[model samples]
Target: MAKRQVQTTKIDGKRVRIVTTTGANGTRVQVTEAEPKEWELQAAQVRALRGMPEYGKQFLLAGDQNSAKRGPRAQMEASAAGMTPGEADMRIYIAGGQLRMIENKVGRGRLSPAQVDRHAALARMGFTVDVLRAVTTEDAAHQAVALVRGWLAENDNQSGQGQPRCSSTACA
Candidate 1:
């Protein structure tokens, strides 16, 4: 039997757990990469989102506040009073002060009521909230990268440029 609680390293978008058992044959080690918990999956998505281009862009954390950071009484009120949830996952700022929201969700995940409200509010403010879906965090990360590129191109095209001019050899 292996301990299901210990997480070792993360691969792709999921954290891996390693276990070791000792028997008459000395020592045996096993690695278990099983079902991912919601937080773990969400964390994987965050990591992927951070991999987007580093040029003229900044990443900022969003969503729920850490419970540990709140006082005991504060936690009680926050849960009871129904604190309004912030934007999901992350907020990225591009060169021209454009802000966008990015969230990664698995098929089984659902947004809470507060989250839904927050998203609606953000949309009304002219911010595009992109929720990416994929089978794995790794796949979602690739989508994030593509999205960043698209946003850059969109801004460029809207700035009186006919079309995006790619300086890379691939475009040439």
Candidate 2:
């Protein structure tokens, strides 16, 4: 059996409400799964990228689908419906001359249906699209840095999945 509970606690000095799940064995499957706002997650990711200028720069607003939602005439009606949903958050330029797109999600966030379809289309077009999930907003920067660090350490151009390990932990 599984049990679920909603609770509020402090994370990195900020109070957050989280939902947790426990498995049949009474072991916690998820701990403090704080659902940070999309903007908050994006900002944290940008901070991570900016701090590691050698690896990545801040996310470009022009390329960020999430950011564009705040601009004037954000929704394009049917005019932008051909490509499925919005694009990934970051178009990371690998030093090895490869490109990988990253979609950031915090906690248990997921991509929308249209985004999933778009991801499939991009894959068919030989584009490497991956979602980078962080366990918590407090550690989102660390997780993002780990991802870029892995990308930087990798010199192989053969495959995007064979990412090099910058340290013991790899981003999920």
Best by lDDT: 2
Clashing pairs in 2: none
**TM-score of candidate 2 relative to the true fold:** 0.58
| For model 2, the run of ten residues with the poorest summed lDDT | 55-64
Per-candidate clashes come to: 0, 0
How does each model score on lDDT? 0.62, 0.63
The residue-by-residue lDDT of candidate 1 on 1-172, one tens digit each, is 3333344787787667777666566666778775454444456656655655554343333444422258879978886887545456656666445677776566556776766787888888887778876656566667767786787777776765423344566334
lDDT of 2 at 66: 45
Q: How far is candidate 1 from the true structure (C-alpha RMSD, Å)?
A: 9.8
Q: What is the C-alpha RMSD of each candidate to the true structure, in Å?
A: 9.8, 10.4
